[model samples]
Target: MPATETSAASTPGAQPSNHITEDEASLYDRQIRLWGLDAQNRMRNSTVLVLSLRSLAHETIKNLVLAGIGRLIIMDGEKVTEEDLGGGFLFREEEGAVGTERTAAALPQIKSLNPLVEVTALPTLEPFVGGDETAMITFLKREKVDVVVACDLSYAQMEAIDAAAHAAHTKFYGAGTYGFYGYVFADLGTHHSFTYTPPGKGAVKEVIRYRSMVQAFDRTNWALTHEKTSEGGSPFGGYRRVLKARQYAPEVAVPVLALWEFEKKHGTLPAGREGQAKELAEITSELQTALGVHPKLLSSSADVVSHFVVHATDYFPPTLAIVGGLLAQDVLRSISRNGWPIVNLLVVDSLRGTATSSPWGVAPDPTPP
Candidate 1:
């Protein structure tokens, strides 16, 4: 495939686009200056899919629109509600309605901000995760979509996107934030994990991290054999390579002696909702206690750290805005350029306020597909 505006490199899509409006062109002047004409055009022509895309993703999507990401698909199992309004950039107050209708209403707002973009929402997780494979294969097969962003994903969803991106030869990126830390990975069309597995978990942390089948495969680092991913898939072992990954705080139940920190902090849910919220809290506590953190994931050497939104638990807009801004910038770099360690893992160290990454797994050497 020739690299053009339409394709990956010099190869522009053979199909022509409708001209941008004066208004649209005017809005993008500053951005156009940064990327220059060709790159801006590429962004106007690119397509992206975001997964496990929580309320936090709304701002990311909004900024992508501003930057002229041509088309977008947002996949999630949850819906918008009054609670979501706290941080959901796409949230709109409607006539007592809370769902896709509100999400749909929000798309025009993006266009209003920047008419160069088009947006779509997928409020269901069925096809994207814990569902039939063929059901969501169409998503990967779509020609217009150039990349997939796995955001705040479930373990199952991440693997699915990883497989789909590899088979399609498309770019893929992933990011996640814990209480105070986060990680991001950029895959430049190469399966990074398939190359060299990371060292195992015995000398580091002995407990099981995640009890899934692909753990061994992931441990193998794919960033080793990148094919010149301009800004992604670093070939060298990063800061994390020389040291042990960090361990998360251990779980030790001291009996429900202290209000579990919910009521004392939030002053309890509103009157009628208290019972339901309490039950929800109970269920979450039980699950956390049961499943626990997968031991393999903790690493002191991890390049990520917490930037928790003060009200991230409540989904505040400003916090999500900052996150969305960061996510979009990374996406732009992954699509427009290559190399410099654009693997699946991006470590943003708050301790020192630095960001670094390791690549995704790469497939073992094989005949060109």
Candidate 2:
């Protein structure tokens, strides 16, 4: 079937007004006080396109719409199944809900979350399937999308959409959950923002230039080195050894890389099948060697890799909530330009109850002159 677009709003092409209404102001009163009126206005006038309508997307969509994003576009090609109802609150278990298209099944609930927010649904992700992103780029340009959030897609799919987003000059976020683990990656090209300072110092404007996901994944420099201090001596009277680390946790990072590699080679996750764990383990070892990661750091990650291989496709509501909440928060921060956004990659390990950020290929913020 051909691709089609649908909007929950009565007026499909209507753009959000420049100013927030009194009702909107009252509804978002606490958030406005927290981030100030300017940030609220920015969020109220921005449009975000979310790629899939899975569990993570369900959580993110709820947050964005409730927080008063001007418009939201949800694109998904799958149909809702009984399994989806487990983690997808957006999907109901009514008579016809199970077989309905994912986007169609969730549209009413999403719009019901906030009547002020305009919601659109694209019932297919065909445009983003192929290697070329020309169709995706054209769609983004036509819609004037401010940000693109891709949830629960493969690494290649996210990369393709990210390219389209880069071409259209839109901020990009790629997020997905693997059982108890999940990750989020952002590429806001040449992003500019303000950082809080002391009462007398005033806010500081900062600029961060981010690299593409392809570059971040293919980076080869994971080795550490020693350098002399600026004063020509270390505090201990010896040369200071500085480590140039790319990932926040090598144990988690290497396994995730291996998963992506496994998916790329086999065209699917391990899914707990026989010999799949062995294959993933081999891939993990290869990636660790290729990326120059220390064997000791990754030694304890064997169980992580095995668990990931078995449960890569499983979704837990609590895990989704945690990862999705962080992703949504960062999306809001990116839109409002209020706080520090995720530099590039954020990995969440529910087992350890930890969320770590890895700058990856992103460059440091410019030093003040």
Candidate 3:
């Protein structure tokens, strides 16, 4: 969600505020100490694309909107649900459909925090990653999106965003949190770099550390040939037939295709256990396709963090605060339009009270061709 068009913030309803709300001012007090109101203004004028509108996704994004980021494209095909209300704090039980109904549902809440900020949310968002990367790439190229903030997404989707950002010459910041810890990776296109945040590590970096999990399964057909004595201790039985009946899971790419199909069939997954199963199944299927695709496909530190980072934040607001605060810094450094380095890797370990950072050292912002 780049700033293709200047926002309506100066409009009567979307006017900027002089005094921030008590709660909001309090919540963002520390942030003001770091960047001050000037940076907040930059945020108000900037447009950003948030990858998903789930728990963590919604949280970070809402913070941005409240903090006064002018425009937002909250990309997601799913609608709100009981589970969404449970996990996504920004949403309420009385809220209407997320994708179809609320284009500005979250704006009022943001206004409560900062009346000056202007926000318009969009649903029915498409995935940024795909084997058919051309569509999203071309879209972003035309749309003039300034930055992309992606949350817990698939491996290929993360890679697709990285490539799209690079090709379109935009900044891409990928962040995710799970249980207690998460990492943020900033790619300053072919130029620039993140100054404050670090790169990715731990489970988030596992995809890069290990070759394609898909390819491994493809080579051995391990899932199929896997034979074991049944609980009843049957003979060397289930093994032989199991291997013969189906194709290798990875080669079949059932997971990827299935995810595609699930979205097609079910526009809005039901909330609660049912929704989790539906989404999990789709992702598992997508993983299988990685076997046949290029192992390096969609591989980037940001992509890695977005895909593998497990988010345990039960609600949305906290997630948004964390992501918004970190990503906003990256955007500020990028707007300098001067020499800067993109962060290559950032491992934030709460246990260590440390953030492992790998920067592009220093470079100039790539003047878009």
Candidate 4:
């Protein structure tokens, strides 16, 4: 696709489908000045599908809807639990809401967030799961959704969704926050382009080719590869490349990876219990060792592993807000074709107030489909 500038006339009180109306222009005037009318128009025309209604999803939904996306579809089949009431601002003080469906209670608040955007609440995600993907493809086709965001799903479920999105040629994101830790993964597939403005420089055009989560995970390894000798045939020639590529804190990344493995094997998170923390620590140790982290590098990671063990299934609102904010912003960047999107994985450790992103085995194949 070629680049096109916004052609909405500067006339007063114009409301066209492909062009911004006077009221919209005024409402989003500041944002238009920041990202230009074209990007706003792109966002205005795109549809996004967000899975689940957790605290993180709530924050993401708030941002995306306020940004004035054309349509937002939220799907969560469960009822509102008491725990949900504490952190999720969308569910609060509604009559007979506790045992009823979550979507019914949330739709009103979500709609109230932005009347200009269309919000649809689905009762279930059954159509989007399992080996047969016809239902998922149909859902995407019927809605003309440009992006899919999966929140708080199992690794297998997320992998399946990513595959379906890839098959449909749609952008996909999977994000989850566990207590003070969180991560976001993206599979933009081929043909993703964006415009980025540097601090002082003007707009710079960019394109990104993302690998699927499955491929990235499969290629992630801790050991050195393609080791070459220095001038004197020293064996440490490739150590710098290997270590640099693995710079993200292994203590954090290893435990997150272990959490997925634990979920996959046991079909549920290891609840905080006697010996479970030890098991988690063992898993983290195994992963860290497998990834070739120096044993001495992990001397201080005991606290991180213990934190994950106890809080892997818990949700902290503050951390959720941070991850969700970043996730939603990236979604806007993707839809507007502006700024750099998260390449593959992003991890946050709010306990220490730190975050990092690494391109885990993303293959660079930018060929347009």
Candidate 5:
């Protein structure tokens, strides 16, 4: 039967001492030297709930478990399939393994990653759904889960999870990868603080007020335009300015939004269908234009939009690794309160090797005429 696993420090309500054991100190000696003992202790005190058990989740679970989080609960009702064996290393190709539950198949490997970290497998997400969140919020509060990560779930699903996490006063993360593109969104909820060091400066403390994912999404000023060309040309250049200011380009971002909208309306991603790419392109272009992207920029992003429409449901391992690695690292940073977490949204363009972090919904910009 499926059940929650607990370690010495993982027992619910069990209080771990502030002091690290000599054995623990010796085992985590290198990391202790890097992040300091307090941060390590913070990690040792955290319990993370990760939704889903796909390749991205596989990579994320591996990173977090290896990082020595106190406890990890994986909730995935999916059963292993032949496709799962390709990227989910926790699954085996042996006979009879394909029909096994994903969490069950991956539990041993997750436990093996770090015996010090408590690992639990949840075979169902019964109480979690887009329209309702009572069960999820209750579970989060009941388990005292420090952070919740939703992977490869729909936008509305992520919203539901984020809402529940917000209610529980827990941090939330939503992430997904498509072939060569991916994104991660965080909602640490209203107020969060962490310690950091600046160049030529001592450790500095900082605080951030974050907006929920829904707020951020709603606040994005798709109509905001940049300065008009000096020659009295079009008044909108917002797309170029935003793109120039961001570490990641909007090429993938707009397409992702369009894909979500498509999925929302069509009940599936646009893939392997006749004229779907063209329809998706139309949607992307329409969104890009509506979102105030420069006409030239929209044209330049056509190839990516085309690729995204066709392969929107596909996954690539290398892309998953890059995105998943960052996602895991950020989750730990949020837990340890040691480093800067992604200030909300991070979009990665694997084809160009560029990942951009943008703060959405901070303030609404007037739509450019």
Candidate 6:
């Protein structure tokens, strides 16, 4: 049976703790040695809301729970199917898990990972699905949610949830895995972090201002041109130089963008059916031209677009593990403020075993001397 809808505090025997117990300290000793006890304590008292229960979410939840987060609220309305068993290790057929609500199926395993972390299951995503964010904002405040991790959602859905999180003054992360490729988008509004500058210089505090998902992907921002002094000093050098200099590879970035555009236009992702690849290719070309990317730079985008269109809905465990690990690491960093968080977007290409981060509508503060 599906789990009933519930509040953040509805879980039995799961209550928020103000301080970490000595046993917890011993359990997290290695983590404490790595990032200090203060950071671990921060994680111990933080509450995170994860919106989804797919393969990606499974890996992320495992990591966060094992790390001793104070509270975790998982929201998902879908039921488990046989296909989910492939990458969703949290679900088991032996227990008659198929056809049951995804969160209910996974809750037991998540609880087993760490008994100290309070786990709440929200069987519905009602508040976040609609266009209005009022309900979502209210829910975040009511639950005192510190962070929101939305996984495997569409571009528009993520944008709406991110807006709600921003309104509630909560950090937000949007992550998804597409077969051999995956991406994570973060919006930590006006975030501050402390880092060491030199061996004896002590720690320096830095602030990073981030743009919402919509602002980051705005077509106008993509169209903006910059002066190029090297290529005949042309004032309209296009975004090629700017984008090429970023950490992301053009082949992966462009196709992903095209996939988003395609979804927005069609109201759904292509199912690797006939002619879908060609349509996606056209969208890729249009996006490249709109973004002023050089044709040669993305000349090989056709193969990538086709590949992504076919495998976009497919799930590969290795890709999920890689992307999910990155997502969890960044979430912990954001919550603890121990290290610098992802400025904006992170792309993982499992085929090449490379993960790169690119700033989208956000810039890092200058390093202190």
Global lDDT of each candidate: 0.46, 0.77, 0.45, 0.74, 0.76, 0.78
How big is the positional error of residue 203 in model 3, measured in Å on the Cα after superposition?
Answer: 36
Write candidate 1's Cα lDDT for 116-234 as tens digits: 45556555655567655564566677646787777766434566666666556666666654433444545555332222113452212111111111321332332433343222221
Residue 22 error for model 3, in Å? 21
Instruction: Give the TM-score comparing model 3 with the true structure, all chains together.
Output: 0.52
Local accuracy of candidate 3 as per-residue lDDT tens digits, 152-215: 6644456567766667776677665443344566665443432232235221110111111122
- What TM-score would candidate 4 get against the native? 0.86
**TM-score of model 6 (CA atoms):** 0.88
User: For model 2, how does the per-residue alpha-carbon lDDT over 1-369 read when each residue is reduced to its tens digit?
Assistant: 443343424544333468877778888999999989999999988999998887799899999999988889888889998889998789989646799999889988887888788787888876776536888888888888999999999998888788778877889999999998999999887555655454567676666776567755543433321122111111111111114232356678668878998999888888998899999999889877665565765776898898887899999888899998999998998898877778677888998898877555544322233
The residue-by-residue lDDT of candidate 6 on 199-222, one tens digit each, is 577666677777788777766655
Name the 10 consecutive residues with the lowest summed lDDT in model 2: 231-240
lDDT of model 3, residue 340: 35
Q: Arrange candidates by TM-score, highest first: which order?
A: 6, 5, 2, 4, 1, 3
* Candidate 3 Cα misplacement greater than 4 A, ranges: 1-10, 13-44, 94-108, 127-131, 193-324, 336-342, 350-354, 359-369
Candidate 1 lDDT: 0.46
**Over 4 Å off in model 5, which ranges?**
1-19, 219-246, 363-369
Best of the two (1, 4) by lDDT = 4
How many Å off is the CA of 355 in candidate 2?
Answer: 0.5
- Candidate 5 Cα RMSD (Å): 5.4
Error of 1 at 73 (Å): 2.5
State in Å the error of residue 40, model 6.
0.6
For each candidate in turn, the TM-score is: 0.59, 0.87, 0.52, 0.86, 0.88, 0.88
Query: Number of clashing residue pairs in every model?
Result: 63, 0, 22, 1, 4, 0
